[model samples]
Target: MQQQVYHSLVYHSQSIQAWEKRWFQQQNSSYGLMQQMAWAISQQLGTLFFRQKIKKIAVCCGQGNNAGDGYLVAKYLKQAGFQVEIYAAEPGSSRDLATAVQEAKQAGLQPYSQFDFQTEYEAYVDALFGIGLNRQLDSNWQDIIYGINRQNGLKISIDIPSGLGANTGQPMPVAIKADYTFTGLGFKAGLFTGQGKEYAGKIELISVIPADTELQPIAQLASHQIQLPKRQTFGHKGSYGHVLVIGGHANMGGAVIMAAEAAFAAGAGKVTIACDAKHHTAILSRAPNIMLRDINALTVEQRIALIQQVDAVCFGMGLGRDEWAKEQYQAWFDLIQNSDLEIVLDADALWFLARQPQILNSKTYATPHSGEAATLLQKGTQEIELDRVAAIHTLQQKYQGQWLLKGSGSLILEEKLYICTAGNAGMGTGGMGDVLAGMIASLKAQFKQKIHLHEIVTLHALAGDELAKNGQRGLQAQDMKHAIYQVVNR
Candidate 1:
């Protein structure tokens, strides 16, 4: 199983079967059932150097074609001199399963009825269920999953983890966590968002079907990769917009620095920080290219003088709830409300507006994590987990601007809701939101493309996933700046 770095959608039973039928007909193979699936999996796996060798494999199965995938993988592994054991709890009589069983028998591999984690295993393959799974997993299955987690080897999931809701990304009361997941046919939107990332781990898609078939459904555009605009030989400093980063109270100086540095790294022609005097000195010391000023000392005339030249602004970050900051933000919002200045609202700004509810109608971008989104919706976090789409859509409709609902499957909703198809487990860290907010603001400052907002958000997510491939820690917001540049240029 491989982890997908961006938002994508795969087959959901009906779509996959339709493609498979068309494929078999085209190939003119009479015994194409398990043979075709096995051949596809093997050929795909063979393309990865890291996955070429196998010794032992543990198989988990349910009644669907996903189980068939696991059985087929097990057969392929066994034929290649790898030891494999299959486990099924009342495997049903679906045609897919029967064919898999027949193939297993031919390969001298019989599946067992029970699972034991204590058994020494090199890797585990999840086939419990697929997108059709609706109910909470049984206790026995939970125990098996728990044991699989306790194992000391790699864990792979076929299609999806047996217990994840296909439509919603919610996991059943219990779901097996796979180190990597190989999605068949197409990508599943649910596998990229909410709690989906934690369970799916590294996701790789196996598009066994031909592309000519029109059965593939576009997954929600959650995350994506944006091509960076090229810097022609004739370009100059004014090529990108000047971004004004406003935030960073006395104790939160690092926030403004991070945002400004991120903006510069993201290709801002000029980056300015409207913050405290003390922080201003630190900003110059760390990144001398950044221009810094004290917001409080800026008289009304001076404040107005500064706002006229900037093309885009990023609010919040470490802007506290202090009366002064509140007044500044409110005034800032008032000034920009009627203007066409592109805005990226995050951190305290999001919290403040969410509390006022009535003042959230401006054409700005809002970046909020699940907890922040829950607070704005005035619902428990658990309720938001039940259906992220409804909650995000509710927020998007209530607020006039694009809503980047940040979570496992960070949703990017504008006129149409898009899911991110990229990213990895390593993205589960801090300061990422700050980096994303800066990237979006910088992009708006630089380009006014019809899809600029969508493209930037996608690039940000893909960069995070790329950084994760190295390891988890040390992936700072600053690091993503170069990565973002790379993603956009590509």
Candidate 2:
């Protein structure tokens, strides 16, 4: 099976349930689907045990089909000469679960309701709750989850960790933290974003349903293999579109410099920086290939003329929320309102826009982290991070343009939501967003005939991942310029 097929399409809990229903209809019984799921889990565990030499195992069983899968795993492990025990967290509630428990007992495996925290198991299986869980775990369950976390073993979750919202990826006050999560049927959207990403480590997709089963995913994970258009050998500097990067107020020249350098690295034909005059000498000394302009001295007419000359514009890296910043923002805003040039808004530009919200008509893209997104939506960062999909939709609907919510799982919302899964923790440093903003503008300028927002976002993140190959710590934004060239040229 192609892993890309599973990685690209992410379905929510509702969609997963609908797909399960389709499978149940095809199989003529829900138990048949359960049996297949059990067989898959047993097969996966068999392979894992053989490779890791895992002998002692414990399965935490709940009341639903998840527990049914656990019981079957224990049965197969026992039959294969492994020391396996079942710790029943809850009584089997549904008929399928009850039948599964009876079958496992008939297979000579006994389940204990009381948990022995001191038991030394090489691996622990979590089947307390899967996609159906919606609420916080109770005190008893929290204790068990905490105990599981304390255990020195391989912690594997069945579908999703217990106490995690299947649709939202927000965990309860406390949730199970699994080292590995084997999701069934389809990949859950919750597993790839938010707190779920931290908890659900090393995801493995278990294909229990037929490949032809129809599942409309809510979002597609950004592909790392997206290729840019080939450049002509006879093309000159003027062949590609020009990009104008406007930002870097006093003492913040590095921001716009990084942006310009990134744009140049991303294959922009001509890159210009309209920044404060204070950094002109430093910028020219470092990056002499970029064109420079004194943003403080440029009149509105000159700004509009600059905007007219460029195919794409990127704004708001280190642009302070001062009177000068407002003037620069307003000048560009007026020109953007009158022109159809591609635009990317980030950092302080987003702050100014949040102060006075308007529906933009031009081809605009907004890149806001959780805090910036919260300010735009007039909500708390916690609220925005809780359900990033909802927050992105809300921001796009209000702003009326493409929005990219930058975080661990950067989400780009244009016609559809796309989750970029390429970046690493090394990208959390400063000036990274500036590089990303410049890259988006450069790609938009070079590919004006189509919408490649998601592609640029993915490329920027993949570049960061490439740079982080050395080490995540002390990874600089400047280190990614070569990586960006490598990704775009590839």
Candidate 3:
């Protein structure tokens, strides 16, 4: 049987609008769809309210179809015997919105122009803004959102939390903090990436329309559960794959040891820790199973010979930014650029690549956090954090390789852009990226192209999540070894 997954298509806001527009052009009624959306939401809300024993509701409406959904939702709830009041924007846009206002009024609910939110209620429905918001919120809008956030109740947003960029996931000055977001039509990419994870609480798809094959998603949510084929009974050590962990200056030994340990834990058959000679004893003491090499002694011919033997190389963990480090990077990066060796550029490797500026081969995978990505793009960390999707794409475009921009919702760009939604905040600890780098190298070496980059990323995240079961607080990256072994075996 095929493994079931929690994967879903994540579309850009523009594509959502285009899909809706196309549906309307096909002779479908826009107002009818709006009503269908509001009705579906009301049904969900009604069930939730009945369970919570909530009777009083405050519906906040703006001058858009998003507000229309709110107006209709208010009308339906009032008809269902729930006490409801509307806090609406004056002179709303669209005939659909005007008709919705009329329907609410006819149903005996009066909409007030200003929303002081002084009157307490059991629930608050945020329909003030939607995916169409392109500009930043001014003081008045910010104040309103701030006020809504201050309220103590079950806060539900209609499509998206108002003020969040539909594609970027950055808040437009401010955004609504919702307990539940009853998103319309389909899933927006913003609800899953960047700051979207913080603002968009418990998301539920309303599915207000049929899926259009013509409309393509901008990204895909990576599945949580992964299935790896069981090993052949006849296979030996070489059958799995050999991974060479390549980095560790004299001053930095733990990174290489941790990475090599992770590689072995992730099922790399034969692993080598090539670092400064000073660290070989420590590595052997820590993991006697790992083979060792001296970074300071290896010549160009020796490096080439070593590269030829390994199935994959994970470079740049704890490789310092000093001149000696630069020399090693220059030698290794030049060879890897020309070879078919599967490689993961990480940590200091990403730092060097930003300066050298080379387009990597198809076999190469580069992983960088927001700060590292900022250096690579010559942009600030703020800009990179503002739009992670764009930064990863830009990295791939510039360097021409598979890229993973590490953050809350880690993005992997390969056959398609993917978001790994599994890991927790505890994975934010130091050395996590090194663990991820090792996992990438090990999996890529064993499975090659049969497994996708996104799968490897998701698997690594799953390991992190497993370790975080105890708690997210002060979780160390070195502690992920057993978790990785358990996940890969499962």
lDDT of each: 0.73, 0.84, 0.89
Cα error, candidate 3, residue 167 (Å): 0.4
lDDT of 1: 0.73
| Per-candidate clashes, comma-separated | 34, 0, 0
Error of 3 at 453 (Å): 0.9
Give stretches of model 3 more than 4 Å off.
Answer: 1-7
Model 2 C-alpha lDDT per residue in residues 219-324, reported as the tens digit of each score: 9887777867688899988878799988888968898999989999999999999999999999999889999999888887888788788898998998889888
Ranking of all predicted structures according to lDDT, beginning with the best and ending with the worst: 3, 2, 1
Tens digit of lDDT per residue, candidate 3, span 204-306?
Answer: 9988678788898889888766788898999889988899988898899989888888889988899998899999888888889999999989988999999
Off by over 4 Å in 2: 1-7, 22-27, 211-215, 449-451
What is the Å distance of residue 316 in model 2 from its true position?
A: 1.1
Provide the TM-score for each candidate, comma-separated. Answer: 0.81, 0.95, 0.95
Model 3: how far is 451 from its true place, Å? 1.0
Question: Per-residue error at 271 for model 2, in Å?
Answer: 0.9
